[model samples]
Target: MVFLKILMERSRLPVKNFKEQIMSTIHDNPVVIIQGATGCGKTTQIPQYILDEFIQAGRASECNIVVTQVSLLKCVLILCARSP
Candidate 1:
């Protein structure tokens, strides 16, 4: 839990500031496109947000998330490493 708190604190990226808008848009749409500058947490945060939501709603088992990256394999690995 402490580790999670620390991670959350460190997640003060610009994209974190727009989390509500992003989640709302995702909930209301079947497909969404999010574009942001580099290091804005686009690669690390959004998918986690969606998965967290699914877990909270008791739909984790039903959730299947796939992220495709061209050259950000490190980000993907980091994200996976952070997962519980």
Candidate 2:
């Protein structure tokens, strides 16, 4: 849990400085496009940020965040195949 807490800190992300702007933009728009260089945490961090916002606003149960990655599906299939 401590490890996750440390990782949750925005300071660790390359997008840390832009966190507020990103969240604000998301709040104001129906759709948002986030583009950044590789390892910039776009894929990993943005969804977490949106979920966090919803949680803080007491609307977590109403929030449904979906992130799709083909590689993740492949990994899940591999894990399922390996399971007894």
Candidate 3:
């Protein structure tokens, strides 16, 4: 409970510099193209950052979001099982 609350309360400050750059570009152009290597936060962090921003801006009334990973599911499942 404490851990989850801390996680939920904490902002993405570790990636502040990176987030600023990405957010600036996103603000300038509604469309963006970002490419990064595997395990990079580019896959997970950006969307959450954007969602928070949109909600704060009062523009999240009706948002249709879809998340998909091109990676193989079987391998991912096996990796998860092996992890603690």
lDDT by residue for model 3 over 1-84, one digit each (tens)?
997876554443344448889989988996777766665567677787788787998988755455556456567888999999
Cα RMSD for candidates in order = 9.2, 7.0, 8.9
State the lDDT of candidate 1 residue by residue for 1-84, as single tens digits: 998996876477889899999999988999877888988988788998989999999999988777666458678788999999
Q: So what's the TM-score on candidate 2?
A: 0.67
Compared with the true structure, the alpha-carbon lDDT of candidate 3 equals 0.71
Error of 2 at 66 (Å): 2.6
Top lDDT prediction, candidate number? 1
Better of 1 and 2 by lDDT: 1
lDDT of 1 at 19: 94
lDDT of each: 0.85, 0.82, 0.71
Which segments of candidate 2 are over 4 A away from where they belong?
8-10, 68-84
Which segments of candidate 3 are over 4 A away from where they belong? 2-17, 65-84
Q: Please, what is the TM-score per model?
A: 0.70, 0.67, 0.55
What residue pairs are clashing in model 1?
A: none
In the range 1-84, model 2's lDDT, one tens digit per residue, is 987887776567798778899999988999877877777788878888888888999999999877656678689999999999
